[model samples]
Target: MSANIILFHSVLGLREHERHLAGKLGAAGHAVSLPDLYAGVATDDLEQGFAIKARIGWEVICQRARDALASTPGDTVLAGISMGAGVVASVWALRPLTAKVLLLHGLATVPANIRPGLPVQLHVADTDPFFPEPDVRAWQHAAEAAQTDVRIFRYPNSGHYFSDPALPDYNDTAAALLWQRVLAFLD
Candidate 1:
């Protein structure tokens, strides 16, 4: 199957959240790949989750992304949530892969070295403890400065990682709306 869109998951790896998204994108006619970054090591506890991800090593995580990219066919649209988003951003920086970006649950600081006029979308929780409003606004300015078409949607009063229904942080309404925007952006 030919895929034009691929989404990598957070350090949590290929869970329902990522799989569900892949199904939606596949239904939208984009071959989507949700690679397993964690490689079977996962946790429900937030601190443990962070620790497991850290243990995996950034370079390994990055190379896993590379492997996923190499496996996917056609011109691809890169998308990810949380740490996955960070991975894509890292890849975009080092390799400059030519694809639109759809970032969910996190924002990657667009380096001063990178300029953007291309399409980019970000879906975030308005009250995300990890990414405060001030930080997101600053990111927006930087993205805009690079000419990136940055569209950031905020889920007010929602917890971080709102898209993952299995997580306590999930918000149904916010997740649904985020899906709608993601569909439109990928289209």
Candidate 2:
């Protein structure tokens, strides 16, 4: 079940939860790269997180992501959380050889040209302010049009960032189920 994976962190930055996930993946014999899109800066404040993302600039973050992807295998699996999911989506088209995409807390459009059956998984809060139904629908439409093998895992009544234990939004049951599915997907 070994895989070469590139994991992007949320707008809050490369926090411990991202590291913990990387460790879990590594423990399962996967090689993962957890990039810090916000450099070394991190925060819990939503406003500050937005500020950090703006300061770094999305284009710059995308470039860094490209740099990080350059060293990985062509079939590398790309994984991300929240803002990181958006980041991965932005560059997915460029990496035509990407094997799979795993998104947490958000949904992003799969590249239109991706091969049919390219695996794509999204775990999101059903009523998340960050991922309203309309947005999810659009993402679903795009993936469907691309004929991707997509799976959407929804956690009802959960907060936007429910998977991270350090956040108040954390949901133990959902987090456990998420990991269970994620590990099996990677396997």
Model 1, which residues run further than 4 Å from truth? 1-3, 94-97, 111-115
Clashing pairs counted in every model: 4, 0
Candidate 2 per-residue lDDT over residues 13-102, each given as its tens digit: 988888899999999999999888777999887789899999999999989999888888999998889998988888788877888899
What TM value does model 1 have?
0.90
For candidate 2, the per-residue lDDT at 68 reads 87
lDDT of 2: 0.89
Residue-level lDDT for 54 in candidate 2? 95
lDDT per residue for candidate 1 within 16-92, as digits (tens), equals 76777788788888777778888867655678777887888888988888887886653577787888789877767
TM-score of each: 0.90, 0.97
Consecutive 10-residue window with the lowest summed lDDT within model 1: 90-99
Name every residue pair that clashes in candidate 1: 3-31, 116-146, 116-147, 116-148
User: Each candidate's lDDT (Cα)?
Assistant: 0.79, 0.89
